[model samples]
Target chain A: MRVSLSEFRPPREGAAAPALRELRDEELIERVQQGQRRAFDEIVRRYKGRLNNFILRMVHDPLEAEELTQDTLIRVYVHADKYREIARFSTWVFTIATNLVRNRVRQRKRQPTWLSLNPAPEDDEVPLDPPDPRADPSRQVEREELGRLISHATSRIPEKYRVPFLLREVEQLSYEEIQRVTGLKLGTVRSRINRARARFRRHIKPLLRNEALLAELEQIEARLAAEEGSDSDD
Target chain B: MFCRRARSFISLALDGALPADRTITLTRHLEGCARCREYQTDLQLGRRLLATSAPALADGFEWRLQLRLNRTLQEAARAAASAWDAPPAGAGRWLRGAGLAAVGGLALAAAVGLFLLPGEWSVPAPREPGVPGALVERNAPQEPAPASAPQIAIVEAPATVTSTAGDPTRTSVSGQSRTTWFGREGTGRAVDLRLSGAPDPRGLLERQGWSGGSLEDLRSIATLRDQNRRLRDALAQAQREVILLRAQSDTARGGLAADAGGQREAPQTR
Candidate 1:
């Protein structure tokens, strides 16, 4: 039953067979559950990128996010039999990732350690990885500053708001899905996402003061108002 | 007062959760009110700015994660072997043979392998000259392998009528599908399911989280919650009924006492 990757072609529209990478998460996972080691590898290949980005945003530390993402996938492998048909595989994975993030955050707060045992003092804070040198230097600086401000604003937001906000905005999960992920009421999730977005706006607005942004806002406001008037009339 | 509360509703409005009337009111309010409009702009700016700055995974992210997972799994295997090799001083549980464990694991793996065998997905190929493409069950489809042909491993798994990639609703070309196929003349060949990269939506879902519990555990918790709610509701109704009956009994007792007093007064008068 262990088909060679050479023979592992699924039915696709144009190709003679679908590539291994084209397999759905559920399909890969199903095969994994059925003792296909390569299937699990496929899953790792698919989710690692998305999971890394999500964890990085939440933890704000690159190393920790990688560790947490790895741990999450490991859990998926060991507990493949625990997933049910009722929820999406992605939801389950995200939930695991989020819970791990929460624990890491809680642990960090409990024992505040800014520094770890390292031979060199200079290794205390790892800087952001280098930017593309060929790109304009000034633009890179501005983008970096903006990126840092975004990260800072996100970190400053309360967890109650931040969790739903990140899941909705970054992960692109629906409000109902956010409720499932966080075990929060629908209303509460919406409210928190709203507050988180608003707070983010407050933090970053000063950095991005442009007349063009204001002009766009005005246009959106007008369009919404016209639609609102029609809806109210009805 | 409307300004503060409307701000929260504005988020809902933006998300298209607000009702028609509320949407109209909020929009009209935005048109008249500059402060509220400013609040709306902030919301938009927040969303627009964040959307512009999505995160990218660090370089070598996948390679490192894979390396870590391999190391962890190897370590786990080592730990298991070590535990089996040396049990605690008093515990007799370690007496179980590692060979038996190995057999069990292999057997489980083989069963899983058998379940995934591509032969199970084969639609019955007609070997006879006049076999119709109509909905007729090829009850017995398995054929004895000739010396030259590769052994086609038939999956005894339930007949899953998987269709071609173009149409999901259409059943597999096994004509009338059967859970079990019998040995019949001429209907020996089958084209099994060609499961490519498409997701099997019918695939069972199982997830375990940091809570150290399965989705089943969460489902059971939800079921227990429903039962608790029903019991609480029943208790509340019973309590209400008890109060109503007690009041009625008290009223009857009062009437009886009044009647007794009237009779005593009549006797005194006599």
Candidate 2:
């Protein structure tokens, strides 16, 4: 009598982890639906970066993002029965993440109005210096700082446009996927993403000192417009 | 629409979200408006910067989430199991305990009634159907069951002891319940019960050093035969007198003293 209880438990992450990692995303979800906790474990491990990035940009705090990301996975576990297979699993899962991030934003908005009492987080911490004097790391350090600036700028985008924008730009979700995750109309997805880009450009334009990149962008757009001629989707 | 509406479309155009029909309108406006063209270049730069600089997640995120999930599920299962196993609080707990005990006691009693009753004692059995119920009841003794010791009858039969087998008490091979008896010496020639088919009694008297003899033989050997005979006859005579006196007393309840006086006078005259 081989009892099923022990086998049903998702295998611990030691010997069986590599095999679980090899399973496809939907296959993992199917396993999870059949009560395999390790499958969900793999799903959480796979999507942490993508979900954490969107959540961190939305909530503007790393700790809350981590917390919300955990909350999203838990909701996925609790509501595993309701997942429909016809839909893309990522769309359904990111929708859960998006909804949690939305709720967290609403909760933060409900806090006390004494903004001065809640002092803004300090941002004056210095970046760690390169250790070796001969390490020639100036370019890497500069690029890191630029990346930090870009993250800060993206975080500042308005709440309405922020989620759809991150879904489109950072997560690379299709427009329809952005609509599904954020539960917005197609037009809303388009307009919010556009607005998000315009605001992001306005914020980051003064930080960079690159004339050639801007000139190249203009040449490319002009050439594209010229090539299209009279052909139009309309 | 002039650069005002076209400005919004510059972003959509950069993202290729603009309808093909609206592209011409945005394009003509952008061709005339250098300011909008500059805005478009800035938008593209910002898009490139965001796409390139999207931050990586913190390390060990999945490991932490897995631990938390396992802990939560274990807690939920424990809570559910306890709720199922636990009886209600207060009076219901006491009531349930009492009810379970009562049910167990009843079941045990029922099992005893069903299987433990004596089968041979109840109702008339097939072997004793001719025996009257009253006679059966009258003969039934209110005494403890007798021990398994073999009873020796002190009768005057001639000694018929069987050959001394290895063990007379061994009844299994013989297929009979009786044990072998010992014969008295000098009581005439002994007849072996093996030929006579008389069963041995395996008497305790035989096991002791006492002679296996009838009461008459024992009395004669002790030289008290006449005395023993006389005592037995005297006891029987006394019992007969007692019975006659009881009959006379019943007839002459008030005439007992008068009859005694008349009998004395008659004896004097004679």
- Report the lDDT tens digits of candidate 2 across residue range A127-227: 23335443335544543565577778887788888888888887878889888787789988888987888788778777555676446445545644653
Query: What class would a CAPRI assessor give candidate 2's docking?
Result: incorrect
Clashes of each: 21, 1
Chain A TM-scores, all candidates? 0.70, 0.68
Q: Candidate 1 on A1-234: residue-level lDDT in tens?
A: 222223322222122224556787787778766766666767776687678767877899877888898899988976887887578788889999999999999999999687766675244333333454544655445445555677888888888788898888777788888889899999889889888877777777775577765564455456546755864464
Q: Give candidate 1 misplaced runs (Cα > 4 Å).
A: A1-24, A35-46, A118-142, A210-234, B89-270
Query: Model 2: per-residue lDDT, tens digit, B1-270?
Result: 677688878867766778998998888888888989888877766766665554545544554564556555545434433432232245323322332233223323333333434452122212233554211111122323323322211111122213324322211113321112222211111111111121222232233322221222222223232332333343344334434433443444335445556766887899
Candidate 2: stretches off by over 4 Å: A1-24, A35-42, A111-144, A210-234, B82-270
DockQ: which candidate is best? 1
TM per prediction: 0.52, 0.49
RMSD of 2: 33.6
